[model samples]
Target: MSPPAVPEPFRWTASPCGLVLECRPLEGIAPHLFTTRDAPLSAADLWRRVGRALDAERVATLDQVHGRDVVTIGPGAPPPAGRPKADALVSIDPSVAVAVLAADCVPLLLADRRSGAVAAVHAGWRGTAAGVAISAVEALERRLGVKPRDVTAAIGPSIGACCYEVGHDVRHAFEAARHAAHLLDRWFVSREPGTGIRESKRLHLDLVAANRDQLVFAGVPEAQIHACGLCTAMHLDVLTSYRAEREKAGRIAGAIRCRAYNPA
Candidate 1:
């Protein structure tokens, strides 16, 4: 159950069960990790183990409808009967951890340094178009009294622009969603029809850039955001990719817990 070693900015931690990836900046903010494909367990088992390893009383996840909904978790709040249909989970309860599962989509983790609130976001292209990242940041500020400038984000592995070619329909969706024109231009890289032996015009969406920009737009400093920049499609040795493995793909999770559980 050992994961292959990853590169700088991301270190792999080994244990009896498997490996999890941690980044330095976010490591200083909270107890968090991005799980790998090397774990020899079902997704549920692995997530449970993640909660235990972080010493979290419980871990909260979502049904991930790929929308902008944000769910807030607290120790005193009653647990819901079913997983909430949302793309993001936020918590100020230090005993509770928040996590998001993904294969090709981005698993983004956010932590508030001043307030010790954390959020786990699942941002696919659809979620990105829907501004899910901005929603989470705003939720932290509105519900937990955390400022966007005080939040630090870790953008996990997912499909990268290098391999995420899209058709005009995808571009049209972003436009219809009302993302700023400049951002659309930057995120969607284009290749002319006759260039590079290709027969048609192509566009590639940079999911990382899109989400990072959205965070900055929400008032999180550009310097405070950290992107693993590892593409799930390219790093199949340790990561999972639905686009690469198709029906056989397993999911990876980004989980985070507040450093301590003080409710004062």
Candidate 2:
């Protein structure tokens, strides 16, 4: 299949059976993509599609419990018995692709420019509050010896602040996460009065901003972090969004792979 024509920051690239979005900054360093709603419907089919697109021999994903746990995969590591209960996957093996699925949550991909190590993070509000992005960076540093300064991240299409309204409970969640409390004011926007009823006077949570800030706090340079800026809630035609589609919403995935090892 030929690469489809896509807009700025995201380019269409032929997968085995369909086209996926490739972040320009991550090109060459890692074979990664942010899949759209046009991709396959089933999890197995989606994995196969991603494998074909990147020519990866194997792919790894998670059960994605909105937490900070990071699962590591490599050459000698045993195959995952089941979807591990984690929100992030990291690997230095070129043949293995790590992916994360999300509907409204941020699907974040990170790559180490020097080591070629990569990670896929599923950062929903809960995971964001738990510092999932920072956890991924720390995992890379601890497991692969990749420093945060050398890492580049791409925050994929998700529910942007414009449409992600939340209640005080959401604010309380972040506030309770003392490590993230200082950043809450910047990530949450309180809706003005008359916008709706009392309960609807919600705060809009910026998942992307929260994740980006966490990455920066983890030491990734602000300029190296790229956000797709495509709001899933706003771009229903090309993306799936839980906020806009409710239970009927399908998921989009963000995947990344290391460069093939060359011993020569």
Cα-based lDDT at residue 121, candidate 1: 97
TM-scores of the candidates in the order shown: 0.91, 0.90
- Among all windows of 10 consecutive residues in model 1, the one with the lowest summed lDDT is 191-200
**Cα RMSD for predicted model 1:** 2.9
What overall lDDT, based on C-alpha atoms, would model 1 receive against the true structure? Answer: 0.83
Model 1 ranges with Cα > 4 A deviation: 1-8, 15-17, 40-44, 192-200, 261-264
Model 1, residue 9: distance off in Å is: 3.4
Per residue, candidate 1 scores C-alpha lDDT tens digits across 1-264 of: 455454566788864237778878888879898888866337457756887878887778789898999988865664454699999998877777888889989999998887777899999999999999999999988877788988899988899998898987887899999999989888888666455312447888899999999999999999888888888898888888888999888888888988853332
Q: Which portions of model 2 miss their true places by more than 4 Å? A: 1-8, 180-182, 193-200, 261-264
In the range 61-121, model 2's lDDT, one tens digit per residue, is 8998999999988647754867999999988778788999999999999999888888999
